[model samples]
Target: MNADRARGAGAVRSPSTATFLSFLWPGLGQWYLGRNRLALVYGLPVVAVALAALWQLNGGLADLAIQLFAPSFSLTVLVLIVLLGVWRLISMADAFTAAPLRTKSSRRPTTLFAVLALLAVIGHAAAGFYAWSFYQAGSKMFVAGLGGDFNSVAPGASGSGTSGDLVAKPGATPATADSRINILLTGVDSSVGRNHALNDTIIVASVDPKSRHVVMLSFPRDIAGFPLWNGGTFSGKINSLMTYAGLHKDQFPDGPLPSLIKELGYLLGVPIHYYAAVDLDGFRTLIDKVGGIDINNPRAIDDPDYGGWTDGRPLGFSLSAGVHHLDGQSALAYARSRKGNGDNDFTRARRQQQLLVALARKLTDPSMLTRLPDLLAAASQTVRTNFPADRLSEMLSLSRQVKDDAIQKYVLGPPYALRSTDATTYSLKLDLAKLSALSIKLFGADSRYAANAPASPSKSP
Candidate 1:
């Protein structure tokens, strides 16, 4: 239209109804003010997101982590509704009172940019909300097998887990006492290595949720003549037992792990109900993820003759006395190092116990609560578990059961452990009968390691 026609269009009265309309529905006011471009600026994304939300509401994510993505998606739309309302009200007021709409569209790019910018901003919020919800959903929904809330395993009860272990309040008591839950925590030295290759570390960890008692006992790596998965006996490191199970799957049928579990169960006289296995590398990563640990040892130690790593790496670790902090990789080195005279495999076991204790102290600190998202994010990505996804809260709450001072550590060597003087190739002495008695006491039918008593564990069976 010509300038004269544009001028004669109207007296250009202020759009009293425009802001109200925008306030009512955003794009509606823009459309009423004769700005098709402005109306669509708010209209398109609003329509797109509304459609997306409707589509998602139909149950597309039942088996996967659906809730993780949904809530955040809703929040994004909410933000858009607010922002578009503000922009449409301001722009439509300009179109109403200023003129019959500018004949020239020189400002079109700026308007276009504003609309696109709003979309870009809202889209970012949507992505962030989705990511955060993903982890929150994961931490809430994910469950490691032994984590309490194993209720599904049992018919009526919630099952004996951390959730069931909660002590009655000061005046109230639980409906019933919790039953015991047993787990076999095993570490096999099976990676590519020399010396005592394959099956290296083995332990039985038992928990009595009702009594809040716990037991942990380590089996000597070189406990000769221990029963094997096959219908025979083997004469090497106990750690080798796991390797045998892994390598000779056919001979030991129930997989190699079952035989090892069976023998430990036999010793403890309790059925093993759960299992957790982590490689040497994963142990280090986990420690690092938790922001390291602190261990106090007065004596300075130095021994470089570690055999696990090919180059000059620490199967052996040396430390200048006093308390020190460790990230995951360093912690792993400390736990696995067998160097100084006081730092043999026995010392390594003690170190592992120490590391665990330090980790317990800070795991649930207020500082850690913030870090939980990042730490758990890393964990869910790298770790694998048979744990149900819905019981994570129960496990996190139950983690409080273990205290720094209450953790127990044990070793088998020297006086308590008898190494055959005749057998001279790095073999620990095995005391099957005494060891069994001790095993019964530690992880037995009752204690869940929730005790305040601290004990050092040892064995050569």
Candidate 2:
């Protein structure tokens, strides 16, 4: 009787204990049950997957997070997460089955296994949810055809008649790695009282991947007297171009946004590859989601005549000169207020750049991880971009490597753009020659004026 009891005690293995072990790691429970081959079968694939994921994440989590914006990658991750959940549940169940069916109580082991399976499902479901969110956001953000025909004749291709007579150039390819990338960034002011959306803020972000350099060129909404893409000249406010073109599609077949992009690209002397447009009202939501941003005021601002529009602050904006933390509404006012003393579109443009940098800093803060979901949701509603989703990870990584000093900011004000007026209107006029020189300096041979550039002085023998 004593020998038989000893054998029984030695053979007994709690099914609950084996299940819990597998819950910690696939195959661990099988190993506990002495099923060595089964343990290898369950664990090796997981180990291999982990290593592969780490290899893909060599650029780190930030790069991975950005890559997740690509719909294909996000969907792949969602599938892997689902498969992982299934594998975990299967491993746990296999462990439970292989273990000796003996325990202090059968009810407790069954309950524990059920709870572990439930947890695995919940965890993976949450991961899948976030992945789905990223997929949806990316789908909306990286839309194609938003910028119109990229191969279209840029306003004044020598033989091209006039801006109104432009034609698409067939078989043109997208920007290559050797080329500079120019993205048009615009802020649309579409308030409740406004009849039409006005792209009041226009900035072109030019990036050279080889040099890892970036330049932001801001165009005042009131810029006028600029040469049109065709050989003709425009005499109205630049901001009105998009709306006018949209209304007169018979003349500008590319539609409103694309027409505006092409003209801007022509003026900048570079091919604008992408565009990002943000609604001012939704912009506020984005700012709030990432928390408020901080900016140093160069001078005190007191714009008593400033109308807050739909922002609900009708008393006008006032701020003392110094470093100030601004919430969404105040930041909007800071970027929009033109009635302040010594304030105009030029200063407003600078402030807008300042706010942009600040917002970027805030979004990259480690603490913002907890707010990522909300931030992404806000961004989906507030912003639309046609930038390639696949290249986002590279851009995100490069953006982190770039320091504040390396970024060049220009407002196209003063020397670059002169204020002009007639009996009926006041506008800012572009200094074409100076702009061409600046473009050559920024883009070298990539500049449209490169062919016309003066030859270098000959070297003495």
Residues 272-328 of candidate 1: C-alpha lDDT, one tens digit per residue: 655544445545656677788778865666767754443445456677879888767
**Candidate 2, 70-166: lDDT as tens digits:** 9899999888988988999999999887777554445447778889999988988998888888887776666655544322211111122122322
Q: Which numbered prediction scores highest in TM-score against the true structure?
A: 2
The alpha-carbon RMSD values of the candidates against the true structure, listed in the order shown, are 11.8, 6.1
Q: Worst lDDT window (10 residues) for model 2?
A: 152-161
Candidate 2 residues lying further than 4 Å off, grouped into runs, are: 1-10, 103-108, 147-178, 309-314, 456-461
- Local lDDT at 231 for model 1: 45
TM-score, prediction 1: 0.58
In model 2, residue pairs whose N, Cα or C atoms come closer than 3 Å (at least 3 residues apart or on different chains), thus clashing, are: 155-229, 163-230
Q: Tell me each candidate's TM-score.
A: 0.58, 0.88
